[model samples]
Target: MRTGLLLTTLALGLSTTALPASAETLHLFGPFKDEHGATAPIKGSASAMLDTTKNTLTYRFEDNGLSGPVTAAHLHGPAADGQDAGVLAPIDGPYTTRMTGTLQLTPEQVKEVQAGQSYINLHTEKYPDGEARAQLTTDLTGHKHHME
Candidate 1:
């Protein structure tokens, strides 16, 4: 349950009145844990590079222990931590460690990401709902947070 986080944000338009229309980049990261919270402790980490200039969200993942092979991976969103939302995009995978890829993001999706409303979920047969869940954040550090 080590929670060490470093969050740095470089956004073109930080103004409340306007959405960024210029170059923006977000270095976001977080750790993966059992979706049911403390029911089963899995280990992993995920990182993301959201570049508005390219309209792409590049995500990378590291898996330590999972109940089973990943059945699916996705960027689920428009919700806050501990909440559930529909998949905003599917992460391509034969899923293995260092799972990383770039995904095109809509303007609205970018907004969701910037607002801390999106998360990455890795699904497996043992837990079809989600085996690894990382509430994506601007944090550059922090691998796992244990339930208190």
Candidate 2:
């Protein structure tokens, strides 16, 4: 547990030499599930470091057992759980099993992300709508919201 916490701290650019409560970063993460009407044999994970100060979100994402190669990836939201919304940002990718990129969040996007109203959606040939999806629901740093 200590190791995990320390690793998370380091990953988020937090240093012990910094002042207490200096969390300008938020870690948003979750695993992909076949819920939200997705109907493919996909499983995966998504994680991101949201630097609120810069309104930039750096993402680390991976997926496995997808029905087909990824056709598109996006950050979709401003919607509630079990609800579907339009894409807010395109996820940069090699569009394979693993991908990473950075997104410059608009003010509205930042607000929505902070409110847990955002999700990662990977579209595939088998399911052009979506293969599997994951919601970025909380700040692991405990600086803001908590995942349920």
* lDDT by residue for model 1 (39-80), tens: 655677777889876678988888667877889999999998
lDDT of 2 by residue, 1-148 (tens): 9999989989677556453554478878877777545566666678888877678888887788887788989999998756889998998766878888899989789889888899898888767888688788774443322222
**After superposition, candidate 1 runs with Cα above 4 Å error:** 1-21, 140-148
For each candidate, give its TM-score against the true structure: 0.77, 0.74
Best candidate according to TM-score:
1
Question: Which portions of model 2 miss their true places by more than 4 Å?
Answer: 1-23, 35-38, 139-148
Compared with the true structure, all predictions reach lDDT values of: 0.78, 0.78
* Model 2, position 119: C-alpha lDDT score: 88
Q: How much is the lDDT of residue 16 in candidate 2? A: 61
Model 2 residue 5 lDDT score: 92
* Candidate 2 Cα lDDT to native: 0.78
